[model samples]
Target: MKYECARVLRGHDGPVFAVRFNEKGTYCMSCGSDRTIRLWNPHREGTDGPTSALMIKTYKGLHGYEIRDVAIENDNSKFVSCGRDKAVFQWDVASGKTIRKFEGHVSSVNAVTYNDDCSVLATASYDSTVRLWDVRARNSFVPIQTLDDFTDSVTSVLVTDHEIVASCVDGFVRTYDLRAGLLTEDNLHHPVTSLAMTSDLNCIVASTTKGHIRLFESKSGVELNAY
Candidate 1:
């Protein structure tokens, strides 16, 4: 397949930790070690072929430290970001305003993902736990369920149909059932840098700093391929 560079997003002073586009794919959002969140147009009109994206807005001062990961809600109205601030913040996409702050993780949050309807959100943290929160519920920021089977920090998390899979720094990927509770664990034997599941919920792909890219059966730890 042929590939080409489309757009370059700039403006953060420090290393960018995460970048994601909304479900509509019209705008892209980025966060970084500079402790700022920026939203920009990924497909701006009347731009030259190699032009940089037009930054729509820049948000600072809310997060105390670097922002690691960002997830745009399915509806395209808001998005969530988590990072070294040890918390998660939901922001209004149009107004660039903070809608809600979910503060509970004692350690830096490594990742965040939302459910199908955006009614639920899941977060992984350096505290070695995975927490699930009700997106629309307020006044109680406590996680509805806490999955803490990992012995080390949880590096990333993916929320599937009815399950939650978390990648751990200790070389394991643990899967939990929202109904059945903890289900199984896959031994990567090397720190798992990230975790992702196929949209059809048939495959799981994981990457590690050791230069390993692996694919597995989503429901089971059965290996399919690796590089």
Candidate 2:
């Protein structure tokens, strides 16, 4: 595989905590510890020279706290973000206006993921819980299920077709089958920092604090490889 170094977008006064490429792959959205979110057009060529890259536009004032995670809808029309202020904001990408603010998490939200259909959103928080919100319904932010056995905070979460996977500070990764209402598996030797799913939805990649990446079979929750 080959890669090209694109423009370096520099505006945030603090470290960037989360970034998501839009569905069309033409633009990218980012949020950070600076309590701001920025939108960039990565394909725009720089005018001055090769050293410069275009900074398209920016979206600000959506969060009052440090924005930790961002999830863009499939249509690219809207996006959602969670922050340390225990709030989630939904924004219209075109107008950059706050469409709605969902509040429920008692602590900082660490992770956020939108469903494939963009109808539901899942958020993980330091309060050791994951809440699901119906984006289309008003006043529908609620925790469908709470998985509690973590000795520490929940760091990341990924929602799959039939299950939800969450990583905790205790170095354990757990899977909850939404239909079964039970934790299917718990395995790991170090705190998991992030989670990603393969395009086929058959595999899951988890990054741990121990500087290791683990790949697991999504269905059985069995380790396929650990690096």
Candidate 3:
């Protein structure tokens, strides 16, 4: 495999906190301390220039504070963003308008993501809680469920078909099985900052502040390896 610099997205004014490619990798959504979200077409054609990566759209004014993270839905029609404002803004990709604002977190929201079908949104926050919101529910702004089992800030969250996984500053990675109603906890003994799952959905990869990356079996919470 070969990798090279494709194009540089130079619109954001400050540090970009998160950048996520859509499921198809044709485009991406990014947000940061600039309190703005920009959509980019990284593979745009024609002669390369300083701004070769075409900035398709810029979504702004909805977030009152620095945006911490953003996640795109599977269809790429909409995306969600969370940040220091303590609210999640669900935006329409084409119109660049906020469709809904899901607010409840008392502190900064560190991460936000959608479930497999984009029916549910899971958010991790400095409030030491992970909240789940039902996107299909039109009239509700409150979370359908809130999981506050962490003693410290919850930094990352991801949802699978049957499980919602969250990692916290408390040094634990917790997985909640939605169908089986079971909870599994894996103590890493370090403040976990990020979480990712394998494409096969069978393993979890967690990164901690101590620079440790640990892999665990999804079902059994067994540590497979560490780096």
Q: For model 1, state the Cα shift of residue 151 in Å.
A: 1.0
Clash count for each candidate, listed in order shown: 0, 1, 0
lDDT of 3 by residue, 47-93 (tens): 35854688888999988899999999888889999999898989998
The digit string of per-residue lDDT tens for model 2 on 137-211 reads 876656554667667778888877777888888787778877887776567877889888898888889898889
Q: Whole-model Cα lDDT per candidate?
A: 0.86, 0.81, 0.91
Q: Residue 9 deviation, candidate 1, in Å? A: 1.0
Over 4 Å off, model 2: 1-4, 46-53
* Per-model root-mean-square deviation over C-alphas: 1.8, 2.2, 2.0
The sequence of per-residue lDDT tens digits that candidate 1 reaches over residues 82-113 is: 98879899988778789999888989999998
Please give the lDDT score at residue 6 for candidate 3: 68
Residue 109 lDDT (model 3): 96
Give the backbone clash total of model 3.
0
Cα miss at 77, model 2 (Å)?
1.3
TM-score of 2: 0.90
How big is the positional error of residue 168 in model 1, measured in Å on the Cα after superposition?
0.7
